[model samples]
Target: MLLAHPALLADRVREYETLSALDADEGGAAARRRMDDIAYSLCVATGTADVDAAVVAARHRLPGARVHDDSLITAMHRLRR
Candidate 1:
């Protein structure tokens, strides 16, 4: 979606990143995690329809990145209403 048209979601990540920066701690680790969450959500949302490709792309984006166990990804995937 947005990838096909980068501009569509261009500022979104930056906006979220800025929001994350506000919560900077321990030299911005919290902010980094927030950025990761933002990216993960985008990829996951895109991947839900194409799980394989999306997961691969997301993983590639963070090859050695270790996501926190208690991150928001699980909660985002769980909410159903």
Candidate 2:
């Protein structure tokens, strides 16, 4: 969804990635807080919600992002389950 809407997501991705990098350096309490704020704002603007309370509520039920994706080698394997 984000890549599909670069005009709306580019800044967001950049912001999040920057925050993540900062956090990785061992001290980013404030930056991490700001990242959460930025994320909430971006999510709201994307027609998902426009209120902090709403954003928090929505995020509470949100699923975890996939850290990695696996490629399937065969349709048969995919449907084996």
Candidate 3:
């Protein structure tokens, strides 16, 4: 769903590859955090409530995928650039 969602701005394939690498390394907190940030960005871009709902639904489907709440986009957006 996230990949299919039109608001996703990052490269899905590259993100997935990075995530896979992080998982293999087993101690990639920074990489994992980036993945969370990307997920949150996609969710926020889709809709504010989407992240939570999608994570729940995705967990049910994949069962092993790690999803986290990285809801920083709103705050990031609010920052005066």
Sort by lDDT, top down from the best: 2, 3, 1
lDDT of each: 0.50, 0.53, 0.51
Best by TM-score: 2
Q: Residue by residue across 28-54, what tens digits does model 2's lDDT show?
A: 677657877776766665555543443
lDDT of 1: 0.50
Q: Model 3, 33: alpha-carbon shift in Å?
A: 0.9
Clashing residue pairs for model 1: none
Structural similarity to truth (TM-score) of each candidate:
0.30, 0.38, 0.36
Candidate with the larger TM-score of 2 and 3: 2
Summarize candidate 3's per-residue lDDT along 1-81 as a digit string, tens digits. Answer: 233332233354345456756673365677767777766654554444654554444333342344554457656878856
RMSD to the true structure for each prediction, in A, is 14.1, 8.4, 14.5
Give the winner by lDDT: 1 or 2: 2
lDDT of 1 by residue, 44-66 (tens): 54554443454444443443435
Model 2 segments more than 4 A misplaced = 1-8, 24-26, 49-81
